[model samples]
Target: MNTDMTRNDFRTVAREALLAAVQGLVLAIVVLPCGLAFVVLTLVSLAFVPLGIGLLTTPAVLTGVRALADTRRKLAAQWCGIHVPAVYQPLPRGGSPWTRTFVLLRDPQVRRDLLWLPVDMTAGFVTALLPALVVFYPLQGIMLAAGLWRAYVPATGESTWYLFVPVSGQGTAFLAAVLGVAILAVGWRRTPRLLAAHFRLTRAVLGGDAELAERVRVLTETRRDAVDTSAAELRRIERDLHDGAQARLV
Candidate 1:
């Protein structure tokens, strides 16, 4: 891909991921009260068995974490134009339910995803703060400008109009305002890049490539073992038939 195009793709992916995150956050905030209520109700029903509630909470939390990881992977593939192989292998049917559940719990990718959820949430929260400050600070400044102008402009003391005019108070305020706006704009522009960097860093630290290589190695070993076993079985069948038929003839 062209470097610029790749960057653009990454940006699009980042935007989608961020948007998803924002949506998740909003949903969490909105649903948190109701969720807590449900938990309380469950606890009451369970006679306040704290352990039971804790057990239930674990799966719910893990499920949410997995969803976030899947969303990230989808966004990465669709927008960032990076293809990552699925880390999960389905088990054959006829296995016991417990065995299947155990296999799922042991999956490295799922564990990594569980670990990443909190980190991603933290990063998203921090990234959001910059934009929030940018919006709030300028509005505060505007409010202050009006009051400051009225209070000091007609006073007999040192002239303060320099604070607002091209050569006065107005000029100084304008500069400050411009600086604030610049900071806000820069923060908005860099949010996507920061998100992309976080995604890449997490993938690297979590051993994504190592996991993939390990899976490939296991597959190769399995194929080799199957071939060997098949050859041995064939040899045994041939020997048995030959020995039995010859002995009977004798």
Candidate 2:
């Protein structure tokens, strides 16, 4: 029974590690293009400023930026199990385009999202690449151990080491394979944690800090509303009693 439990645990860890590696690769592929588009949109928004076209178009650009940011937030939440909730200020209604644009620009959450663009691109890039790289490096080592390194890089006569010790000759390939196995052993334990750490950083930076405050504000308003409703109900009851029952008693 213990052995069966151990095997199940091992399988679970392996599955999670594989999923994290795939998630990292997907993130790497998607984030780069999204980042580039975000940067381009920002520049275009700026250029439109001089021509006064931004008054008409900047909101759309900003909307795209928000959409991109939202994608990152959603991915982090879904893949990494780190929920980064959004808390955007309500925009004023019935405003001109320019007025709405300025309002969006002035919002704290919008500003934070704008700043998150470059940071997400850079940090998310590293975050997304590291898991895949960590996994790939070990596979490369195994391939080197199989003597395929000779075909890949023909005549580089350098020694490879797991730490500080030298690995040389055909037997050295076996040592490389051993090192690769060791890396896989350790990586299965560490990869998920490392990936979670990266997502935690993302959540902290991109997520709302004012959640508690917002909750408090909402609660306060709700409490007041409830009190007002109760008082209104009591007044209606009193009126009914006075007009019906009290008149009958008199």
Candidate 3:
């Protein structure tokens, strides 16, 4: 029974890790082009800001940027159980294009979203792709081990390195397979964690815990101030003294 349960646990974890890895592959592919488009549009629109064309276009582009970030937030929450809040300031309605443009520019969240685009394309792209790579890359080495190296050696006419093992013959190919199994052993433990890291990175930039922390800080300070004010009022009441406003009224 214990052996059966252990096998079941392994199967469950492997299934979850495979699903997450594939999901991350999809995310990585989608974010790359979207991030590039947004980055180019933002730069082009901002360049035209002085000419007034950017006044309208900039805000629209920024709205798209926010939408992209929000979509990632949704994906993070829905797919990875990571809750990232949207904390953008509301833009004034019925305003001129210039007013809207400046309003977006003034928003810190807009800057954060802009910052996240490049990062999503670069660091985020890597993180999102890593889980799939970790989980699947070893399979290629195993294929090489299983005589696939012959097809490659004739085609390439040279020795190919399979994860630092040179695969020119059966013995070397077998060595590649051993390395592959070693990598698979490591990946089995890390695939789901790697997938979660991608979403965690998204949340870090897209207002996850920082926004909550700031809100908590503000609430704490407000509560402290209220307590101090109440204590001061009680002290005055005990001493039968009136504050400035009360004394003036009396």
RMSD of candidate 2 to the truth, in angstroms, is 6.4
Tell how far residue 141 is off in model 2, in angstroms.
Answer: 0.8
**C-alpha displacement of 160 in model 3, angstroms?**
1.4
**Per-residue C-alpha lDDT of model 2 across residues 83-124, encoded as one tens digit per residue:** 887777676788888888888888777887888778768887
Model 1 lDDT per residue over 32-59, tens place: 3433444344345334234455344444
lDDT of 1: 0.53
Ranking by lDDT: 3, 2, 1
For candidate 1, give the lDDT of residue 151: 53
Please tell me which predicted candidate would have the highest lDDT against the true structure: 3
Candidate 2 ranges with C-alpha deviation above 4 Å: 155-172, 212-250
Against the reference, the lDDT scores of all candidates come to 0.53, 0.77, 0.87
Clashing pairs in 3: none
Candidate ranking under TM-score, highest first, comes to 3, 2, 1
At residue 107, give the lDDT of candidate 1: 74
The C-alpha TM-scores of every prediction are: 0.53, 0.77, 0.82
Tell me the spans in candidate 3 whose CA falls farther than 4 Å from its real position.
208-250
